[model samples]
Target: MSIDAPYATLDPDRVLDAVTACGLWPDGRLLALNSYENRVWQVGLEETSPVIAKFYRPHRWSDAAILEEHAFAQELAEAEIPVVAPLPFGGRTLLHHDGFRYALTPRRGGRAPSLESTEQLEWLGRLIARIHSIGARQPFEHRGRLDRATLIAKPMQAVLSSTLLPSSLHAAYRAAAERVDRAVADRFEAVGPIRQLRLHGDCHPGNVLWTDAGPHFVDLDDARMGPAVQDLWMLANDEKAMSALLDGYQQMRDFDFGELALMPALRAMRQLHYAGWIAERWHDPAFPAAFPFAGEARWWEQHIADLHELSEELT
Candidate 1:
């Protein structure tokens, strides 16, 4: 018979066992957090502070790539940047248990940052500028780069080959996806050679946490080398908000305003990649339940229309 499921193997007992192996006593408390790419839990300790355990998805990343992610977090912490870095246990950052590679980090609690406040937006801008400054200092050897091939081509191929797209919509999706792909390529070419640096990769609002002290970044799992704009554009909801962010960014470092032109193309690529990501992970039990919209025909129709709209803007 087939196995139960992918994450079903990661039972509470296994989660606790993973923590106990690290020389910590669990208090029988485990809360599954909001993560789909990986299994993350907040385990309460007997006497010590609680910690968040992130179990890597099987075969998702190699040891070297995971180490590079840890190294980047450690580097940011050393620079006095407020980032949730993985705690070193027994002089090691990554530990393997029951065929799962995991890392432990101290628990950090905070609400989402207030994007509406100019002060808050500027604060984040300054923090991101510092991150980019350090990111430009070095490069990742093992991790992948965020480019057209990884974001567009691979995702397009995956969607076309998979049964995720209904037969009726396949032609429309293919045509729109190809148009968006070409538009993205042309936009990148028009922008010319932009600086590529080690980035937090996914810098949306959910990834940032706000406290009385300030904002601190969490979850560098998606960390990779990409343009500075990739990190900045997602946070901005409008031109005024973007200007406010740039106002602060320019204070700490030189802002490349030309990157603004690539925003439309970047947004289109992310939209295309998201569908492919869901389709690729559809076999996972969590995907269908979590993303119910992906199962419907209307959603795919809207997606095609959105793609065409994005393509129009890119042209």
Candidate 2:
């Protein structure tokens, strides 16, 4: 059958059936959660509390890679970190049904963490530090890295290959992107060799939920090996905020100050990767509906201009 939507294969009935297969009796109520990369649902149970069921995007990750992420989250939980880990079902964390891979976790409900609060930022910083401590303990055997090849090269290739990019904007985009790529490489070179460790990979404010106890990290879908600053930079907005976060971070672990110099390069890489991600996923019906701007020639023009500006900033 042809796929019309990203979750075309993930019907509500299939999700409930998957939960039932895990020995959890579903109450026939399924609430689809906010997610673009994967299909997540809050499945109501008959006797127990509702559980969050996440069906991984097909072909996005290998079985071993997803299992590695589960192992990392389990490690953090074992250390008493406030991270939502996958609940093992039938002696395994990863399960397969109807050609989809998924994992079940107890529902965690909380509002977004207040990034504006110094106290809250500090608390989060400490928690992230503790997570980094465990992340540094070992390397992922199956997972990938956050470096030039993955961040810049592969993404650039994807954008060039995708039909989403307007032909009129191709020359400008290629010129700007190549310049940005070079600048990124140069910035990384100037920073010299920095330490890389397993990180939360995507530590934006949305991934964190705050409550009375503290903040708990939820998605490990992007977890991989990368510079520690990769996790820290996304949390802070300005110098003052970064200082506040580092204050708490230092209390728990020593951070390499040199990594600060690499932030611009990382930002440029993220910009490129994000565009490529949208272009690559444009075939999924959700992408067009959610990111309609990407289809416009003016948007590509502006995107190319932004790339040029990033290259200038890097220079």
Candidate 3:
């Protein structure tokens, strides 16, 4: 199988078969979920609630790392936190079917939480704090970290190698990236020592599902070690929203205000990382289909402009 087209052979049959192997009979209804790094599906079952089956991206994470994520989610769920944890089949959460590693989770349904809602923001903040409390108990043995090198340098490299980035803009892109890199490093150094714990590394409104029961946290795929603010910033769009979030967070856990300074750096890093990810994954057909704008040279120009703006904002 080609590394670029990792999902080439993952047809509907394979998806259903993987689910059936988990001792669950599929009702032939398969719906693809909105995921790129990993393939996810909502598989209806025989007279039972549907299950969310996740097929991990090829070579992205090791068995140990994936298990750690599963264990963390299970821990959160066991603590009465609303986390969508893997449903262990025959005492194993991670299962294999024809070279594809997959796991079954109960299909959870909810609309995107309104980050604009102060009540929801505070509520989500408290839940995030609880997640961090559990996350602090121990560090991940095999998972990744949310740092400059891991998030910035590597993604920048990927962006550099992408053919999608026009050669004409190469020099400008590199210069902007370098400036952003230095600024991120300076910000990290300025922040001094940080208290990093396992975090929901990609904490945004989209990852949170809002229902009457409040919120349900899904997709811990990007879970990593980082400061508490990494989980808070994406959910709070403004200063007032951040204050509300912090108010709720402080009710459950003490938040270091110093980490707020890292927000600009984080935002810049995210921007770079997103571009890098799209570049690296452009080999996959789904990326091109989903991000048609990226194929245009104009988009790269805009991306370069944004990077420069981020660099200036940080500096």
Candidate 4:
């Protein structure tokens, strides 16, 4: 953490003071939460329950984009969807202390959602559908949509720019990546236009918290305009689970069956994006320590091979 340039200035005293800046008294309990793109902490209060403070990554989002995320969360919460929205401090949700932009929200606890359970998948599907319903009501003026360029091409560029890929493997990497890129583009064109809507952009299991009562959404950091299927595909691991989820989803809202075929391309884009994200953020001390595999030459070999395999499937 000390080696990370982004968090170098953010110490324990500063974190607590950021809370105090919001007119909250800190009990001096600060625990680092599991987040890499941005820094998050569980800050204990002197009186009431603890609050989750999320310090936004520097330069990643503008003020309007961040506020748009807050507004979307509030919209979902207002619609009776169990989403963890930011709490206003002095009627402002976004705050700044020193240089970091941050927000405060009530801490909600739950375990990872059970994707294997049919009932759980259905419940999650319904909640996601409801979220999409609210998401579809309007458009995001600031946050950008999830698309092929951002997810695929941009990431592959990051990998090429970085020294992570050995010199010998550069040609192979580029060939595999370009092949995947063209195939991904073809799939998107074939799918024609998709119903783009505001979505929980990164809707994987890790982002969802499940309790006995039901699941609640946390972390709107990745919230953006995207296909509704972007929120649905990551929740299921197999055909059966996806079927259950779609069954529950169709009960509340009509879904485009065409988007189902777009999964492979989306998955391929995500694969490229993941590698690219690690490459782009490798300068951050946290990324290298966490993704040691990216440091290895063989990983690049495997990644290129995987890209080739994905290209085969896509073509």
Candidate 5:
């Protein structure tokens, strides 16, 4: 599909047709479509058996990343991590349809548990540690350190250059952005070498599914070779959430105290990046309501508050 093509509206019949074409479904009823960066359809066939057909938007993701994800999923499956392995179709990791790339995997049954609960929070932390443990021993090339400078400068540059954000938010966003930039720099300067490992770039609670066995991470699309702390930082932004997750990780592997101490600043950088992205995409009607211009403004306000709090500690 064209990079500028409108978002595709998934219909049950169309999903079934696509599944039938892939030979995974002679006949089935589409249960639900999980529409996000990609489009996934839950298909129910005979005997309560279900599978998911995922259509990848080439415009949204680089071909390299998509293919790498397929390989990564395969490797994770081999390591006996509970994951939905992609099925081969037409000898390709993706199926081309109307200029969009698509793939399929059987749906793993599970519900997303609340991160608010102590038990669930602990479970999440341990699961992340296991993923990191498995990732640690794997032979993957490192994508050099995503240092404080790059993380801060990139979003600030983007937000400043983009005309998407309103003038009302311009000052607040820039101020918050600068504060975080300085905070990250100061924190990293005092810290030792930060270790890089294969990381699940987006490790928010939503990305993990709690199953009978344990939490199974989906959307390995964001997986990359970067600082392991990037994953931890994302999950640890919320104090309660991080405490729970850390409890779990400590059970499985060791965590660097310095890195844990530096998490607040790292997490602030992450939130800043996301705020910039949201501001840049605000004009789009399909942009998530949760991240509207007002939301971005509020985030910057809160971010500045956090930055002040961190700055006080640093001083």
Candidate 6:
């Protein structure tokens, strides 16, 4: 669990030992292992219900994020928001094991849809509106806001600083980074105050779980206070999808059209962030093809082209 310890090779026996120590299940078959930055597993025993075990990466995630998520989950539960509830383990919101921190939560019964239908998209919009409304009334602080600069710097820095990626990707990464930076800078300067608010940060289809209650959002790991439009842009990267989601969102919350116009560029920048991260972590095959730069450069080229098209429409 030391930072120097090889994180890629986790000991299954040690993880099972940790499970037993937690008093949940000493002997249960590890059902599935998810390839995330953090260690995740589906643990189940015949006598008891199944649950998810998440081991946090030390130094990678801030303690504030862990605490904030627990607090936010509790607040949402109190408000009857259909979100995953985080359970306290090891007398702390986060549990320490093998030099790393971990948290456990009961796995809800449902799966995320690959694509959001019109009705589902509308429901998602309303749900987000409600979350924003509730979050607005609460006193909270985020590590930082998502501006053009932060969106550009974090990924660029990650790409440049990462030792995992090869030298061949450096030039392509820098060029893409510069393109995103320029686009964001020009777009932000033209538009003022693109409606900042508490956002889920990552609202892609993967994070949404469809349950009997409706769409329930999980994996609030990236939740933070940022531009309200950020979530919208993240969800609606394509015109058809954006229109559907926006139609759904507008039904619940009042928003300005001006901010909607900025979504394409915002989304393009967001895509670049993921792309750069994937390039750094490309050695790992779990990176999704949906994000920019993960596949051929043509995908990113099209995204940049879309940004240009959106800019003309906005003007």
Tens digits of per-residue lDDT, candidate 6, 70-164, equal 78877777787778867766556677666657777788767774354777777777877777777666544644566655666776777667653
* Predictions in order: lDDT: 0.91, 0.89, 0.92, 0.91, 0.66, 0.66
Cα lDDT over the full model 6: 0.66
Tens-place lDDT per residue, model 5, 1-315, is 234334344456667777777766435566656554566777776664677778765454567667767877777778777656788877776766545567878777678767668788787777677777877776344332355544667767766766555567668767766766776777877786776666666777677778777778777766766556667665554778777878888999887767776766666766666656554554443565544554455655665576566555554
Q: Estimate TM-scores for all models.
A: 0.97, 0.97, 0.99, 0.97, 0.78, 0.80
Pull out the clashing pairs in model 1: none
- Per-residue C-alpha lDDT of model 4 across residues 34-123, encoded as one tens digit per residue: 899999999999979999999998888999999999999999999999999999988999998988889999999999999999999999
For candidate 5, the 10 contiguous residues with the lowest summed lDDT are 1-10
Once superposed on the true structure, which residue ranges of model 4 sit more than 4 Å away at CA?
A: 1-4
Instruction: List pairs with backbone clashes in candidate 3.
Output: none
Q: Write the per-residue lDDT of candidate 2 for residues 34-58, one digit (tens) a residue.
A: 8888889999999889999999888
Task: Kindly report which residue pairs in candidate 6 clash with one another.
Answer: 1-98
- In model 3, the runs with Cα more than 4 Å from the true position are none
Q: Which regions of candidate 6 are displaced past 4 Å?
A: 2-9, 114-116, 138-142, 161-176, 237-244, 279-315
Per-model C-alpha RMSD: 1.5, 1.2, 0.8, 1.5, 3.8, 4.1
Q: What is the lDDT, from 0 to 100, of the residue 32 in candidate 4?
A: 97
State the lDDT at 12 in candidate 3. 96
Off by over 4 Å in 5: 6-17, 26-28, 31-34, 46-48, 114-122, 138-151, 161-163, 168-172, 233-244, 288-315
Per-residue CA lDDT of model 1 for 1-315, tens digit only, reads 112255777899999999999999999999999998999999999988899999988777899999999999999999999999999988999998987889999999999988899999999999899999989999999889998898889888888887778999999999999999999999999999988899999999999999899999999999999889888989999998898888888888897888899899889999999998888878788888999999898999999999999999998
Question: What's the lDDT for residue 113 in model 5?
Answer: 69
TM-score of 4: 0.97
lDDT of 6 at 137: 69
